[model samples]
Target chain A: MTTPIRENTASESPRAELELATRDALGALRHVAACLARRSHELLGLSCLPGPAGQGRLLVAVADDGRLERLLAELRALPEVCGAQLSRAAGAALVPAAPVAA
Target chain B: MTRTTGARLIADSLVRHGIKAVAGIPGGANLPLFDAISQTPTRIVLARHEQGAGFIAQGMARVTGQAQVCLATSGPGVMNLLTAIADAKADSVPLVCLAGQVPRALMGTDAFQEVDVYGLTIPIAKHNVLARRAADLPRIMEEAFAIAVSGRPGPVVVDVPRDVQTEEFDFTSWPAPRLGSGPAESPGTPGPADLAFAASLLARCERPVLYCGGGARGAGAEIAVLAELLDAPVVTTLMGLGLLPPGHPRLAGMIGMHGAPAANHLLTRCDMLVAVGARFDDRATGDAKRFCPGASVIHIDIDPSEHGKNRAAHVPLAGDAVRTLGALIPLVPARARPAWTAIRASLGLAHPYALPGLDDPKSPYGVLAAAAEILGPEAVVATDVGQNQMRAAQAWPCHAPGKFLTSGGLGTMGFGLPAAIGAALADPSQPVACVTGDGGLLMNVQELATLAELGLPVKILLMDNGVLGLVRQQQALFVGGRYTASTFAARPDFVALAASFGIAAIDLEPCRDARAALAAVLAAPGPALARIPVDPDAHVYPMVPPGAANHEMILEKRHDHAHS
Candidate 1:
């Protein structure tokens, strides 16, 4: 896995956050983490909470490099994932937070 | 309803799915599965090495576009199969691999032949499971096939304990096979608005190019229609070679590192690049920042994960290529740009593909071209990695998808012979050629016995350069010509070696008429090996160094400034 070096455009922010709903399977989370690592996105924070009927509510904060929308679209496309939407977080939201080590 | 052992259930599942053959080596742990397989008519190709068995399965899967099977035992057996599994994942070939494991009770204990097969295979396989109970066999088999053949097809591992294989179980009926999780076969049709935007983009473009990858295999007809409509040239990634006929007028040729100079230059000049199914891999997009610098990309791919993974698409249409292109065809109008076509033609003529000693049958490039010519356009060619593989890629005229099979993403050496065997098995009538180098062939030389035993009509076109050609070439160009262990201190006499395996052999270098003799040998009824001697100094040209842009190519000495 390689981290893509970010080249900032005028309209883009340096970092962004996303929340995903996925099947409560380790494989699904592993796949997501690996993909983010491959894309060079830093996972600022992660929270895996139980959702309806074994579904997992995964909150992830990633260092955005202008391709957040594209990344969100790709996350939603995952078979194990049902929904992916953007979110905002302050530095205080970093609970057990740090880049998720792949 | 029938009461049967887990092994029987597995064999029955394969039979139910219409699997005609399997490849594997029977070991202590997997013997029950082999025994059950024997009760059926499924031909089991016994390979000497487990890795060879996995590749043989890959060969069949690549050719048939179906999930094929390979079996191995626990521990070392599964470990040996890892490379092929990784290779399958990299190339998107569908494979369902079964490995026998230790008894359920013995797992996690340091019992003989016990290892964490599930943990090791997780990263490499699309999905993997361990069967703790015999009753789960039918469902596991069904899901395995489904997952293996689904979106972005890849290998799936099913690890069954030795005890599970022997345990008897009752089932009401064998579960019908199912398609794995993915978008609907008929994806949400591209909206009219999307098509309109694409049409408008096409309408305004002066120099538009259609770039494709492996995902565009079955969309050739649609691609041809779009190419005609837009008057644009088609450039394919290595895996996308046959998406257009070899000599199609609109084809600008393959693009990437080691790609044609004309095609790379065309990419640099294009205003709009409609990348259908191409992920813009580093190999294809050298220095991604500079690749197709000014071109606006419209990426179409079934896997949404690929949409902006590498290169962002202005219009990211997520649908099947055939359907997506089918919908867009009606909106676009046909127009021919004479100036653009004339420029492309001039570029091609300026940088010709004709290399030194290519007309000599004994040379590496010459041998590949001659073999391809003799075999005709329909022949399936499998190539091992490095120079031999690239030469085959450059010379072979692939008329259809699946005809030219090689490990593109993984670039696995020792892939040719076994894959050729699998190809031959998949299509018994079509002639198959395994183009391999000495360094690669020796990696799994043990498979020669398997090939001899089967006597399938797979011709081994062995190019004996006596060195790891590509690495040696790089060493010469970049490492001050200090050849380390690239050269073989004592190369095997391939002719005598072939005879030792009970197969016919021919030495092309010693022949009076090498081309004719080579053709004669290829035309023969059974398996044969032809040793074509080549200079170790031969290099594949028009190469873009690791981090250079596509247009920043190091051309052949004779053609350095030819395109200008």
Candidate 2:
């Protein structure tokens, strides 16, 4: 479900991440990964971690060219996916610049 | 506790789901499952090709608006069924595909008929499960049907190993009753504010066009009511045909490439586009970015992803057509826009929708019209892609949803014949018309034998041109008419071929009264093929020439571009 608004389009971003609650079952990640690949969203990174029994969390980062909202909707629609939400960008570990090691 | 093999459980699941017939071709990997299903009341249809079986299932699903089943073995069988699965996904058809795989022990040992059905189907299917244990049969089968017909319905693949099928499992009882729901029950509904906003927009916009698509099927009355309420002209996409009667006054005719110029022209001038359950497919929306450039959108669809994937909806109402329209209808007041009506009429008069030689029974459009007239309104039409498809879209008078079945989203060439068979099987009482061209017919020609055996009232209107009509038309229009592989070296004598297959066939080349010949052939009984000799130079006109704007059609007549 989406909030009905006149200007609901996702703002443009070069990269974005989606956090998903998924079933901890065989081939469940395949369904999530396939959704991104089908839409030609270049997968930047993916990490899956075991949660409570029969539950898993998938954090996926993809190259987004202003199509993130639509992609988020598709990811949420997957059967194995219990929930999916766009992650806050500032929390991403991979920043463009970092302090050099001396 | 009841103890049963996984195969028996699957058969019981099929019975519990109210499936009377399942289509597929059995192979080495799936013999156990087939044996178990045979023991049940469900009749198994042995299709000549896996692809044929898949389309047969699609046919039933499309006609009945419910989930249908198809079976296939591993490796080659799964591979053959892939196209149909992809087609179902593209067109949003609900299908449960049960595929057999190698045994658990030999699964990764390079065993005979070993293929990774899960990985191959992941991208195409709504969801796919690899049933690794015999104990998982009940849950897996229930989930497969649930996922298939659920939101934005699509095909689901359930791959069970041969060992799992034969291995005995103790199951207390079936998990649930009727895991399947009709096409996901149309997702969600629009909020009251959303309806008010949409109604306000409708009231404000001077020139509004209601664009509907496949998702709008089974909501004909709602669409008609909305069109009337808004005083708007309705433009249906290729998949959205029969949402309203052909004679409906508000119909601007089908839109996009290979669509009517009047409707295409009207689209350019509309101020508001009320897209009812329509996804703006590239074929329907030529140069997506440029389609309805100045118009504000009120997008309504069952799927959330569709809303802003292409053109952004000014007021996106994410819900099924019926519920959304049912709510919005009362909010909007009835009014007439004479200017809009006059504009539509002027455009229509300039570009008369009726094709040239439409009355000639030997012509492309003529044969389909004759078939529809002879078969009457109850007839279901399933068309193969290309010129024959466009002709049927243009000429046929489909009165309701599901009456016109085409591989709209996938545009699969071999879909018509087998799908027609499935449609006929869904309701043997009604007649089915299969429209196909020379190119598409050969792709699934084996189904002709299936049609012969079934002896259903499926009148195949074969347009036999020496070339792949659409490809040749494209080559002619865009490629400087190089005349390459589009032309066939030698075509089969369709009449003789039909006779060889023990099915009656008639060629209209030499017939003095083609109308009467078509009538007699269509009316005679079981299955018959009528071959109409189409001119190789003939092409579907008002084409939006690839990558062009919808307004810039390559019209067949100069008057199409002339201002009235």
Candidate 3:
């Protein structure tokens, strides 16, 4: 029996809060990887790659037709990515939040 | 006087002057000439395009070492011939371009197919004249040929009006002048005073260098004598690539934008630079101010205008390269400096701007080296522009002067095959080989039929990389790896194309035994083609990008490991 957490403000809705939390989690993952590689000899003892690697990849969850093609084109145009690709997987459930004026 | 059409007189004059073939495309302006061609003993070859006709004539002239004639109608036809004519002018090939003009009455009336042929060709041609009357045809034709062949051979134009070709006229032969009859005298030996002055400079300078140009071509023996007397290193321009043997200790490679590093370094470091018959083109001198800053320049050439045009000279000797060098040989006092010799030897040891991926036995450099070794000093070599040109300039060992001919000044892409055709014509006794890249050869591939028909013993070595290798190299280095339209996915099978032209063809892939096949093709009496397949992803090293200094060359591009 978990108590339902209340939303802080109408502007800061649950959906917006969840999106910001996901972005922070992705950034933290990359930051921690870089720190560990720098201090590998003292810590995990893993060797670092020779050249500079790019930032973490963006995962856009979209279901619209032709959306993947457009996103792939945009990503291909980027200088960081030498190449690009598309993939499909099982959809994840979205937790419902308190409704706001729509 | 017996009446004859202007066209008939012109055709008869060309025949009388020993011209057996005429190349041109039939058009309204020159219909009468075409009609006359059909009835005359002279064979008229209808070229697909005006430029093609010019090249054909160039080929004929090159083989014959005589003036080859090409015809073109007014306006666009004449314009299309500009490039070939410019090439002829630069390479000193003898050619005659007879361009038809609108009738004199409607000359400036903005008539259809009307353009000022004389005015347009003035800059490119050695000489040009507008025939005002039908009677002028015979005289103009004779003068055109004489002008084309005499004094630094180049193209001459005789613009005949459309109506003049139809008009009837009495004809007579123009009086032929003696060889040395003009105000422009044949070059004499350098005067005693000038020779003594040059000797003084040579005597004082410890690290003197002799830089020869194409003008010293026919005087190879004289150059050898001069080099021996001075104990000076000899470096050549692109046009003078084969002036000195590469094996000679005194011989430094070519000097310029794509020049050898040792040559450029020596040029900058030398105490005295004796420039013989070489114009200091901007490409050779990176920045005129910074070029040969430490050297005291001594310039000699037949053309006086070339003397202070690009770089300043401390001593200017205006005369032929051979005569000047010969005269100076007697005056020069032998001065040997162990220090200078050691410097030159050390510079020689310094490895050239590294050319990666060319170390493989099947590389273009290997093929060039093998060919040079097989042919030795006897075989004449011609090259087309781009990577092949640079590679040949760098790797091929030309043992004698005038053995290597290329479009140096213009860097024309379609030059090699036709030039080889011309070179073959110039000396039918010798075997001529044309080394060209895939992109350069395709520019004028139609000449394959010309070679077949001529039955000339010219071998074409095609390096097929599928892409415009030089342009791609540029894109990769400067354009941040964005491959543009330079890449080609599909290319015609050159071997099959050569076979269709009745030429014996051999296609050699990488790691294949190309030596025997190349030898067989070279040994063949008639025309042949040897197509060598190169890596599509391969790039020529020691490349200096446009606007970049020669010292800042990129030996190789770094690629991502994952992509490889």
Candidate 4:
């Protein structure tokens, strides 16, 4: 009798699948810069850090401060980002500060 | 064929021949070919300087063993490539240079940027061509590549006009050109009569020596066999550094101005000198009339002009090194003479001219010795000019053929890193180690990006002495230590610079940890840098002053004061 070939089940192979998914998700999210450039305003600061499951951190700062809330609302509507949060931080350092209750 | 410009055809032909990269400096006359290249599949790399372009092409050719092309716009641009092109000729590297010429329509008009490139390069190049028409481009390029790489490889120049490059042609393809066969037949073995005479002379001689040079490089195994057969010590010229293993039992260090004391001592004492494929250059044999005062010389080389050019030879055998050695190896009998062996052993025991403070517990010699031990004999070592080159030549023990590569003849300052890149590209399996000084490394620091982009695993050892070591030493010994422009300050952080180029770099200084640093760098799987800071005042000793007699070599400075 021939032995059956071992097959990877979805539950057992989630890590590799998650890696592929995360890369695609982050790649799409990064392309948002080009999209925003078509709308208005020049990009002030843009940073990207790799994360898990085709997910990655992207931070974009604009010259105008009020634009952050509107940008967050647009990002939340996108399918790639799992969640969106916005807060004001010191502009010089570009560091994330404690979230101001929204 | 329909009417077309020579430049377009040449560029098209080169592209057809699988040329991917062309390094050059653009100018008026050669702009046509540049236009064609810009439109063709070939990518043109603009060099900051024409000389740099020539060396870059040389590096590329040395790695590929194929003819790499360089272009220069006319006059000074073409002249700039002369040194590197001649270097390629001497080192047997293959390259083709396209020099822009004044328009053929205005021939002999002394057009702007016009120079007689062919006449200027006649003595330096393997071949040269001045395209008479647009139709000549395809055939000329084919012949250029053929001549550049055939037999003893060298550079070939093709001068084309601005009009020729822009002219369009209907020719679909370049016809292949035929190349001539190998060098004309050279006398292989010494005549029976000459062999008998040489044998008789050797039998009567008390001390006989074998001096080898660059011509003997490809015949290492044969040279070793001949050395064993004759039971004589072998010494080489500077260009013949890696021809034979430096540590061979029968091998003596290099012979010449900067040659070892033991080798020169043996040369002075020998009764018979057998020169093989060596020209006995003035640097090798100072005052040829006085060199080997006691010896009768037997010279063997393929070039007949060199037979008696430098020194008188009793037996001049004109042949390739392999064939000449083949003829001589059999005539000499292998007899165990304990007396001769004892003399050789005695010469071996005579300590090498000591570097005054190299024996210090912490010194560059220790670092070199450790490196030699770790890298072993098979490691390919390239050195930049100055004290580091001299020190590496004296201290590093090369055990195999082609293991030591340096810019010996040209003594190029920024040669180490790029040449190491070439050596690494040539043989990926072997480890390439470059020993460069801080001053020399900074000369071509831009090459760090090339190394990183190519992902070559070349290990660089920087000797940071905060001064141009050789110049400083010369000023100290000859000039009154005025220092002049030799002082270097505000050096860049090499580690950070290397990091910016995506290369790993470690400073082997502050930690005073050369061993660990070297080991770590050597063990790394990619290109890395290890900077070792030496005292700025450190000088290379045992220097024979320029134009001074060899016997008057200053082994050490007379006082603590620096010579200016």
Compute DockQ for each candidate against the true complex.
0.18, 0.24, 0.00, 0.00
At residue B62, candidate 1 shows an lDDT of 92
How good is the docking of model 4, by CAPRI class?
incorrect
In candidate 2, the residue pairs with backbone N, CA or C atoms under 3 Å apart (3 or more residues apart, or in different chains) clash, namely: none
> TM for chain B in all models?
0.96, 0.96, 0.87, 0.83
- Using alpha carbons, what is the TM-score of model 1? 0.91
lDDT-wise, the better of 2 and 4 is 2
The TM-score that candidate 2 achieves is: 0.94
Any runs in candidate 1 off by more than 4 Å, and if so which?
Answer: A1-24, A29-86, A89-102, B173-187, B558-564
Candidate 1: the clashing residue pairs are A3-A40
Candidate 1: tens digits of C-alpha lDDT, residues B18-100: 78999998887899999999999888999989999999999999999999999999989988999999999888888999999
Residue B411 lDDT in candidate 1: 93
Q: How many backbone clashes does candidate 3 have?
A: 2
Error of 4 at B318 (Å): 2.1
lDDT of each: 0.83, 0.84, 0.68, 0.69
Tens digits of per-residue lDDT, candidate 3, B388-493, equal: 8888888778877657767777778887887787567556677788899899888878888877887888899898898887777666666776668987787989
Please identify which of the two predictions, 1 or 3, would achieve the higher TM-score against the true structure. 1
Q: Candidate order by TM-score, highest to lowest? A: 2, 1, 3, 4
Output the better candidate (2/4) by DockQ.
2
Better of 1 and 4 by TM-score: 1
Candidate 4 lDDT by residue in tens digits, B1-564 = 556677767877778767777778898888878887898888676765676677667766755667988899888899987877777766666789999888888767787778888667755666666777676677788878876765446788888877777766677566776443212111345577876776676666667788988667678888787667667788988767777765577788887766687777778777778887787776677756567877888787755545555666777776677877776777777755567778767865873576544433136666676777777777878788888888887777876545666666567788778767666765667667888999989877777877786677789888888899888887877787768899887887888988998999988766556577687788788799887778877777666566644444566555444442
Which regions of candidate 3 are displaced past 4 Å? A1-102, B1-22, B31-46, B59-66, B110-112, B149-151, B176-195, B352-361, B374-376, B426-430, B544-564
